[model samples]
Target: MENRELILSIKDLQISFKTDSGTVSAVRGVNFELHKGETVAIVGESGSGKSVTTKAVMGLLASNAKIEQGSIYYTWNDFHTGEKKEVDLVKLSEEELQKEIRGQKIAMVFQDPMTSLDPTMTIGKQIMEPMIYHYKKSKKEAYEKAVELLQLVGITDAERRMKNYPHQLSGGMRQRIVIAIALSCDPYVLICDEPTTALDVTIQAKILKLIQDIQKKKDLSVIYITHDLGVVAKVADHINVMYAGKIVETGTTEEIFYDPRHPYTWGLLSSMPDLTTNSDELYTIPGTPPNLVKEIKGDAFARRNQYALNIDYRIDPPMFDVKGSDTHKVASWLMHEKAPKVEMPETLKQRIEAMKRGEEV
Candidate 1:
């Protein structure tokens, strides 16, 4: 069984994609660690580099994308010695990564289940695919385990679903199959890249619950990549809030939701689709992210940040400590002595106050 004591650790990672136009920096100096069985949500909007960061961890980056810097370390039980030791995954070659870890140890539940599963392959075959490739399990044994996996993922009538193809199942069922495949090998780390993105609200909730249940039961470290704060609130133990190509703020889920110090996070939480609020006019972080091709001389969110102090325009704020546990940190000019004490949005202030009061918000 996987342990909850802590697992993958990614530090100071930088990644950029080489395009014809020039290099587009997708992930820049990202830092976060995933504890064993800990559900760490990488929350950010589209183009925020959440997926790309995890993709670098998986050794799944495209040929054009170069992982410019940083270390990704993993701790696993040594079968022979039965001792735990940290392995530097970033140093592993492409072949070694694919051969030794990838799915067998650290698996990924990709976004868009339909595209992930082969149209030609049956549900059972798709679920069994990873085992065959990594575990070298025989067809019969793999098939039997595949059925059990389907059943484990809450797929009723597993035998029936096993015979069906991706196009045959509903969106929810397809998603379950994706989870089943990711878990077929009982991987230590599960990187779920927006598994609920394409599903409806009802399905999204169900899938989220299913993953939580599985995590509790199997003790899987999950790196959840999504822009949905609702989903993050539901499952995340620790939250890493990403913006542009960097992590602007990070803390426990409660910290991010209640005491969020970053302007971008404020915009996200305030913009939640609450009925009382004007959902018709969703609050957005104004202006665009910095163009990475060109050098970023200042804080990347300076243009969009309503609370950007003058210093933000010229200086890139390093992550500064905040009024919380050591884990809580934010990169903002306001933390500096020279920066102004801009007030947080009233809605966020109210929300934080409500949280402190233990009132229903």
Candidate 2:
């Protein structure tokens, strides 16, 4: 993996929004890396800063939001000069970002297609708009590319759908169009913020498959912001488990799913329903996330963590390297050598074993 090129690097990203009541700390010291052509998923419950972190990457945060500290370093290869250039996105002005970066280099597919798409515009026009604005393509060229995009997204009758409005398409078709628009400019990085939340179960699976297929076809690096572990399992090459505005765990998908180290990640995996789950009641994480309006002295998840130590209550745990794996890291006191050795729940252990045996779990 060291030989793989780094597409984006985020370090010590802290984002806060100024509300009437007070400042809400949305993303606190979040950090991660996206390598070329890899899929990384940021998973957590609502208000855990999954979407907020991605919004910062896309420069789509609210006007009241302030990026107090951090740097989003993006590296791109100039096709004309064949030179690689790195830019700190945090320093780029809104106009510069709009002109030079957004849509052209980095594109985002929002959660809800209905909200993201304009009902007044035709689907074809919407898909071609970015190409015209960013690529400076003629209307004819943009129209041709739009039709090709619709076909690439598996939409039939691409030429005919160009004249239809957003309301004229089905939910799944609308989402496919949104994806087509995002891919129109051939971006280096693609951000999907809960892209399937509004679709039904079957449609959700199809959308995920579509994204995966397109990523492979275009060799696009992807960042998925989602709370659904099942979706993460299906798409993510790397997994970052976020909790209360901080990343609690970071590892490859196999490590995060099979050998999870953080309590929050354990809770999330346990909550995911599988066919082997025979219990009458579904497992859920106890307690709510901490309020962001107030300052947090210790670990934000300490109160909710059943395996939390006294040290976890006194000081926030730093990201500790997991043994035998340099890539796996967890922010929890339980990872310490002197901490009491605790095992995950028996049910979860059994489920993992069943999954390893190729059973439906």
Q: How far off is residue 185 in model 1, in Å?
A: 0.9
Report the poorest 10 consecutive residues by lDDT, candidate 2. 1-10
Residue pairs with backbone overlap in model 1 = 6-35, 6-36, 7-36
lDDT tens readout by residue for model 2, 1-361: 4437899999999999999979999999999999999999999999999988888888889999999999999998999999999999999999999998898899999989999899999999999999999889999999999999999999999999999999999999999999999999999899999999999999999999999999989989999999898899899999999988899999999999889889888898888887887687789989889999999878999899898888888899999999999789999999999999999988889888887787875
lDDT of 2: 0.92
Error of 1 at 173 (Å): 0.6
Per-model TM against the reference: 0.94, 0.98
Give Cα distance to truth, residue 232, candidate 1, Å: 0.4
- How would you encode candidate 1's per-residue C-alpha lDDT over 250-304 as one tens digit per residue? 9999889878888888888887765443337666677776777878878889888
Model 1, C-alpha of 248: deviation from truth (Å): 0.6
Candidate lDDT scores, in order, read 0.86, 0.92
Q: What lDDT does candidate 2 reach at residue 165?
A: 99
Query: Stretches of candidate 2 above 4 Å error?
Result: 1-3
Return the top candidate by lDDT.
2
Q: What is the lDDT of residue 350 in candidate 2?
A: 88
Return the lDDT, model 1, position 262: 87
